[model samples]
Target: MITAEGLTKRFADKTAVDDVSFTVQPGRVTGFLGPNGAGKSTTMRMIVGLDRPTAGRTTVNGAEYGRHRAPLTEVGVLLDAKAVHTGRTARSHLRAMAATHGIPNSRVDEVIDITGIGSVAGKRAGKFSLGMGQRLGIAAALLGDPHTLILDEPVNGLDPEGVRWVRQFVRHAASEGRTVLLSSHLMSEMAQTADHVIVLGRGKVLADADLGDLVRAWTTLGVRVRSPRAAELAAAIAGPAVEIVTTSPETLDVVGVPAARIGDLAAERGIPIHELTPTTGSLEDAYLALTGESVEYHSKEIA
Candidate 1:
């Protein structure tokens, strides 16, 4: 298990990650989600001992990664695929990382095959495509066969096949009771890949819970009712708190009110409803609803 306790990091005048706390347990894929510059990369760097935190700490299996005798054997991380030496071949890069902990070449080959990078194992790292580079990085992470895997944007530049492969690999790792913490900005992908989600905005965690619970808790349910007297019904449930947007004639997007109340109000007013259906409320809308003004960079178009 990977646990971060009150983890904080300050860069001179700016705070990157502030008093963040979350637990990543084994037997499930815990998704790390946030928009760009939300301190996700900084947090991942701190987890792997790449960045020094200003205060607080993160521990893997009750031990700081730096304090562990065999760091590579404890946790495998793929922060940046291009961090590898361009001059070396993919197989050579894995071999070098393996040599750090005296891991055998046989193990290196094992991971290369496991990540399906065996075909390009002998190709130079410089000539590999973005997808191939990501595969190479995954192979390097699996070289030690660590119990915990921290992958930052694992499918950033992957093809469709590579995306599917990474998803399956993540599930397989967790099925073996190994810890997997995958960070990505893609919400739909996170919805499908994760058992739970840890959402961050700016530098703080806004929501941390299961995918369904987070959606239900943060996302407002919007129901569109097409009634003969739409305006009359709207006035019945009208309030400053309730957000109402009319996208079409005789249709209204109502928020901050339950569907049952809407129905009751319409029935009382003798408004005959023809269409009442669930309108899609986006994940971004849910995030904004929960965090309010905490979201970074609200553009004119987005806001």
Candidate 2:
């Protein structure tokens, strides 16, 4: 498990992370999310001891990451896939990292195969593609078979197949009771992979809860109804507690009422309903709503 209490970081004139606190439990995949400049990267760096926290503390298990006797065996980290030496082959790179902690060559081969980088293990790191580099980075992280895994944008440059592989890999790791903390900009994938979520905005903790609870709290459920007499049906159900929006000439988007009730109302009004579909709030919807005010860079919409 990973624990942070009042974690803070300041770079000269500006504070990048501000008194953040959250606990990542084991046997589950926890997603880390935020907009640009929200201190997500900075917070991950602090967790792995890449940067010192100005105040408070964070622990990988029960102590600072650096204090572990064999850090690699205790926690596996993948902050940057491009941090490897340009001159070394993928195999050589993994071997070097393993050597530091006395990890045997046999284990290095295991990770290479596990990450599906064996086909290019002999290739130079500098010549590898973005996807291959990410694979190599993941192989290195798994070299020690650590109890905890921290991955930052593991699918940044991956193809559709690679993305699916990562999703399944993290889920499997969590199932085996390993603590996994993952950061990603892909909300759809995160929604499928994470059991819990922790959102950060402007260096502060914005939300920390189960995935379902967070989505329900931040977004509203809606139902879509299609009929030729959409306007008439909408008017019949219009009230202070209900909201209806005309999406198309024959479709209405409704809120504050269930699909079953909407169907019954349409039937009672003698409206010929062609379609009725209920839409629940997604992780993307919750993310946008929660971080709407915390975005540091805003792009003007194009005409």
Candidate 3:
């Protein structure tokens, strides 16, 4: 497991990570999510001892990452796919990393095959495409077969097949009792891949919970109503905290009110209800609702 207690980092007058604390347990995939400039990269860097924290500390398997004699065998990290030497081939890069820890050539070959990069193993790292570079980086991380894995945007440039392969690979790693903490901007993929989520906004920890609980806690259940007198029903239900949007002449989307309340109000008003369905909230919906105020960069609307 990985633990962070009051983890904080600062660069001059700017604070990159602010007293963040969380645990990434073993046997599950924990997702780290944030908008741009939310300090995710800094936090991950601190975990691997790349950036020293200004205060507090982080530990992997009960010890600081740098304290381990064979750090690669304790934790594997893939912070940047393009961090490799461009002059070296994929095979040479993996071989160099393995040689540092006395990892055998057989293990290097195993990861190359496991990552499905055998065909391009001899290709120059600089000439490889983004997807292929990501594959080579993953192969290096798995070179040690560490107990914990920390990957940042592992699927950033992957194709659909590559994305699925990563998903399955991480799940298999967790099933084998390994700790996995990964960061990604792909909300849909994270929803499908992560067992738990930790949300960060502007260097502060906004949320940390199970996937289902996070969705349920942040988004309210909305009701979709189809009635001929949709406008009338909307006006009747309109009150403080109650929102009603007219999607069509005969349809209304209601929020801050339950389906039962909407149905009862419609019946009492003698409105002809054709459909009354509850809309379940998605992970995207919850994420947007929670981070709506914390988003730093906003795009201008096109006129």
Candidate 4:
């Protein structure tokens, strides 16, 4: 498990992270999400001790990451795939890393095969593609068979097959009771992989809860209604919190109200309703709503 309490970081004139606290337990995959310049990278760096927190503390398996005698065996990290020696082959790189903690040659072979990099084990990392580089980084992280895994954009350069493989692999790791903290911009993949989510905005915690609960908490319940008298129904249901968007002449997307309420309101006004479907919103919708104001960079459309 990993724990952070009152974590904060400041770089000269600006605060990158602020008073963040959360715990990642074993046997589950926790997703870390945020927009650009939201301090996600900084927070991850602090967790692995790459950047010292100005205040508070973070522990991996109940101890500081650097304090562990065999740090690789306690926590596996894949923050950067290109942090390897470009001159070395995949096999040579793994061999050197294993030598550091006295890891066996057999383990290196195991990880190479586990990450599906045996075909290129003899190739130099500099010549490898982005996807191949990511695979090698994962192999190194798994070299020690650590109890916890921290991966940032693990599928950045992967194809569809590779992406699916990573999703299943992380889920399998968590099922075996290993703590996994994953950070990604792929909401669809995160929805399928993570059991919980922690959303950060402008270096502060925005929402942390079960995946479903977080979405429901940030987005208002909405309904899609198809009616012959759509305009009449929309007018009847208009209120302070409700909004009606007409998608077509006979269809309307109503927000801030439940399906049952819309149906009742339409029926009361004698509107001929054909369809009334409820929508609970998606992870992307909730993410945008929660971090709308926290986005640091915005592009203006050209006229």
Task: List, residue by residue over 26-134, the lDDT tens digit for candidate 2.
Answer: 9999999999999999999999999999998999989999999999999999999999998999999999999999999999999999999998999899999999999
Highest-scoring model, lDDT: 2
Position 67, candidate 1: lDDT: 97
lDDT of 4 at 155: 95
- Model 3, residue 237: C-alpha shift (Å): 5.4
What candidate 2 gets wrong by more than 4 Å, as runs, is: 239-242, 246-250
In TM-score terms, which candidate is top? 2
Q: What is the TM-score of each candidate against the true structure?
A: 0.82, 0.95, 0.90, 0.90
Worst 10 residues of 3 by lDDT: 227-236
Compare candidates 2 and 3 on lDDT and give the better one. 2
Q: What lDDT, from 0 to 1, does candidate 1 have?
A: 0.87
Model 4 TM-score? Answer: 0.90
Listed per candidate, the RMSD to the true structure in angstroms reads 3.5, 1.6, 2.4, 2.3
Count backbone overlaps in model 3. 0
Between 2 and 4, whose TM-score is larger?
A: 2
Model 1 misplacement above 4 A? 224-282, 298-303
Question: Pairing residues by index, what is the TM-score of model 3?
Answer: 0.90
Which residue pairs come into collision in candidate 1?
Answer: none
Q: Please give the lDDT score at residue 75 for candidate 2.
A: 93
lDDT score, residue 74, model 3?
A: 91
Summarize candidate 1's per-residue lDDT along 1-303 as a digit string, tens digits: 999999999999999999999999999999987776788899989988999989999999789999998888889899999999999999898889889899999999899888888888998999999999999988888877899999999998899899999999999999999999999877677777899888887889988898778778777778888876888888888998898887777888888777888888878888888887876565556655766666576668765
For each candidate, the alpha-carbon lDDT, in order, equals 0.87, 0.94, 0.93, 0.93
Candidate 2: give the clashing pairs. Answer: none
